[model samples]
Target: MSRLFGAEPAEEAPSFFLEAPRTEKALERGAAGDLRYGLASMQGWRAHMEDAHTACPQLPDRLARWAFFAVFDGHAGGTVARFCAAHLLEHVLAAEALPGADEEDAAPGAVAAALREAFLALDRRMQALSRAEGWEPAGSTAVAVLVSPRRLYFANLGDSRALLCRAAAAAFCTEEHKPGRPRERERIENAGGTVSQQRVNGSLAVSRALGDFDYKAVAWRGPTEQPVSPEPEVSELPRRPDEDEFLLLACDGVWDAFDAAGLCAFARSRLLLSGDPQEVCERVLDAGLYKGSRDNMTCILVCFPAAPGVSQEALQTECELDAYLERRVAGSYLRTGASRGAAGHPCRLKGSAWAGGREGRPGRIWPSRQASGQVAWSSLQGPFGFSRAIADSCQPAEELSPHTDYRPPRVPLGSIFLRSRRGGGQAPANNPPPRFLRPLSCQSCTRTCCRRKRVPAWWACSKAWPQSQIPASPRAEAWPASKSRAPLPPSPPREHPAVRQPPLILWEWPGLLLREA
Candidate 1:
């Protein structure tokens, strides 16, 4: 058993994988009644494509109003998964006590019982075939959902998962069946099999699967009581068409990449971007691939009538946010020493290190440090041109920390602007100076020392500006550089010149203030 399936630390088992991953994906889509489904499968980093899925929006026979979806994650080989995908539904429909013509007559428990019976029956058939043909040892997870007008039925035999999203939240999710689970471990031990490193007999990872015939060889144990049971755990939930948005049935590969909450959020955001279910499914597969899932991946998304639709407003907002981040990243990269122009600057911040503002605010900034690591302060009228209004906004050096550990407060995005410096200090004829919506308060700044260091009548903290050169405003006195930490002399309140001018916004860039010259 160990030789066929390999031992724990599965990554070391080179026999199960190829030299390189295959990223090709196969996608499918279909719709019936109020349910629309999209399916995507990828070989990923696996040696062969082993995952399979089934999506039936409306089942045939007497249960026309029902929808069925399932995902099978095959291990050792693809035979079991493929067989279940093609024949499981037929077996389910053929169950003697299956839900029939009268919606009211067939109880939910009866429907669940029939589904359980179908799983066991299918396993028996597989065992018979394995005995006759002498097939190689393999097993596959089974996670399926049946959607009727009033209820949803879920069944599971292995670790693949099913999730239902309602009112834009995760309403239901299935638990995985692994040998590590207490009940499953107890059952395995009772059937004379040991679980080591969370694997059955230190080999197969799943506790229950359809075709692991070797584990089902215990003569005294019944089919469901075997170390690796063929019987499935069945469950039912009341269906609410109005509140329910979508249902997700996915192989472990997809689950490994995202939790139920994260998956729901990503799907919702994708739906807002594009309403085509197939495109969304493709994107999900691509994401799972990029997120470093080395297994074959498969997923089915069944969108109910209440599923989210594309929003023009949301799309535009996302585009704008992307553009803003791109510009910031480019600016950060250019300022770093990796650029030819920035080679001389060793204190520059890397492009990837520029984090967005905390608490959902916009813009990125790192506060000034002491004299050794302090930002190279450019003159207001020097090569990096700064307007008089901006220079006037400079806060006293005593107001901020002089240590290298000073961290800056987050600034709102789109609040800061690069003013084009004119030769005669005149505003551009075509473009007026940008007005800041409000002055950023230092009271709530994250840097406690910077906030409590000093309080001035004016409302600006230009940590990058030179204290000796700060232009004195009518409301305050110019702070001398020599006595940077000294207390300021008391002065009477006066009308500020900035009141007549457009409010200027200041942002802390790394060792440099970017401007349009």
Candidate 2:
């Protein structure tokens, strides 16, 4: 019964990698829900023979509400690339307990520590993989994103880039971690690996990787030299409620073909048209290969739709949206702002509320409605909530205590109807409690936090929004105010239900590597 609304902690890992067409370790995803990959160990070219791609199916906002992804570039060999594909995200998300992981990992510093451990853990994991394979040839370069409705974390190792095209025009992205950076080069050298003119070992191009056991030591560490830490070049970029755009993760192959402007331009030109990530990847690759990339070329494009509520409604229920919300059918108040209060409907928000779910505060009485319909969704704090940590000492008793936690957040700003789009929605039916409430049955809706912390209570705190302060205006607002005065964008074509959005699940990876000179 307890398992339904609970989610297992997310063990994130590295992601997809594609190499030269020769060894072609290609992984591509299409309309199919499965991620198709083929690796040919064809002697000399086999390692570079394939590509890596995956098509993720979209889930109901109740499940996946965030956009999460990564890209790995295999150097020296495909080991790191393959390893990353197999396990990077898992390691990153799992290292939350390693040294320096804060009790309340809520700040940028704590996040950085987590990233550091994640990178070190990646090195450790790859070293183990190398030991298991009883050889080297299992390394990779990685770049990943941990995205949530409120924040974003972008981490990386090596020259692979993670570019964020702001929702607005004329905005560039975060700095690239390339050999061109002095500190990056110093880090490579300080690790005992020579940064020959900014490049690791003065031979390979990237400064960081997972499994380049061969180029790892300064000089094979003679029989007595200690091995160096092939830790990653990890960084953090916090995502705010405002200013979000598409992301680009790709091997140098793709970048070599397109400059920052070029890549953004190309992706932006076609993004809204396809709305499918893997297809965007394929087109990018096709563009790169055509541009004559001699190296292994791989790329991943993650597009965050600009539309609100249903984000163009991929799955239009025959039932009125109201019926589905269990509304259109009696006694309801604060429907939209209901879940935003200090405490909310345990079961409902456990279904969709910032992806924290019951993990937020078990035993805490959720906010609710007495009668009549009204808006409910608001920042966990307040209406003008700048929305970061505010040390909730003022919280009511039975509040979910502060603790280090992780929840694979659903998409950013997931579309939830605070009130009927129709406006001044109908009263909701006071339906009897469900005959069966199996917590384990609805794993997607279950909050993942309950697993680590031992909670002994479940309470509901249905407070109301203050509309009394509204001055005499032309029209009273719907509350929360969509954050924007304008309406959401046009609906995307539902021509291919199979091409639905991909689940924002955490992934796993192997180690790092160096595939080129």
Candidate 3:
């Protein structure tokens, strides 16, 4: 039996027979455009509530279309989790790599990089606060989602997870970082830490977390080299309005009780019964509690524009109408002899009539041609109810443009440096530096680095050594000295001889450069 936060190990399992005088439940619900979202949390049988969550339908004013949601499961105490809930999203917004609302080159890889840095920044802030306030050995697992109109970016650390339900199934999920996993275990051991009985150093249960200060005590090692790292694994997927249903983020308490498929099925069934996302989240928490989850439970549900429960009947009717119009277009084209237009191109249903005449006041169908050459059917000007007949007969056509066929850029996994370590001394003359380390144009680096920190053109030492041999530290001296430059800060004290400084490496795509042991 492992102890928590330096607490003495118990010979027998601790009992939580005593229940709280009152249940602690929190709920939030909102909408953004066609999307709807809900969040719910319950303390369950636990003596104290240690779970926290966040929901934002729209980000800061600068990034209006973006939304964010997250769940944090705390162990040892709830302070860490609460802290993360309050600041994680803000940090993400502040990341230098994150794209703006209207940036044309906003690629998925850049968004993923921003997410990774956001998690690391949160961890760093917690660590710094813990040092000053003498906080307890507390930590939290986080799963967060950043939703844009066209894409969804996810970041995960520890056991909390983000899952996507699409086509009536769990289409995507973030992998949990557990100590028992082979790769996680290997990282722990390599960092001079141990995993015994599936617990980190026979204590912490997770391999990666937000604020476990004790596990991060190897001063000679970089942040990622600690027994528990805060670096989140980030991934992105294109949003499919036609097929994607909803996204769910939950703590281990919910996940421990239900697998991805089971939860998606349950949520979908509930959504059909009641179109309210808030009610669905409440039911999910209740289900986790009923299933006997041993820890505090938290869950957040985000419904895409196409998700169930939001006017499903109308959508179905629209689909049927679209099919009918397609058939009508084909039939009319054949009957009208496919007349040629002014430009000698095939005229698409230019003079077709659908039973009614142009003089009809209500319930009349009006045909229009989109720029893409697709035919659209709409109701003629009339009272609300009068248009229903024509609206049900024809569906609106989707607008298309040259950029409509754009797909999410496939970022090469190798391009996002998962782990970058500093080499000892200097590199050999024959070999070139990695692509990421190579000197990029100023504009490229500015766009890539975001706004948080300004990176130098050639991020290397001021000495004559090759750029490849430059130290991995972000604080490396700049090559040029401007007349207006401020004086350099004093160097910190040297480390103890017994503690060796490891090489610095970039970790998880293009975020957070860390030293490795």
Top-scoring candidate (TM-score)? 1
Better of 2 and 3 by lDDT: 3
TM for every model, in the order presented, reads 0.64, 0.45, 0.57
RMSD of each: 17.7, 24.8, 28.9
lDDT string for model 2 (103-174, tens) is: 234554665566667667767667776777775465566666655554556777655666776663314343
Rank the candidate models, highest TM-score first.
Answer: 1, 3, 2
How close to the true structure is residue 274 of candidate 3, measured as C-alpha lDDT?
71
Give Cα distance to truth, residue 186, candidate 3, Å: 1.2
133-194: candidate 3 lDDT, tens digit per residue: 99988999999888887888888999889899988789999988888888889888988999
Which digits, one per residue and each the tens of the lDDT, describe model 1 over residues 206-266? 8999998999999998999999998888888998878999998888877776678777877
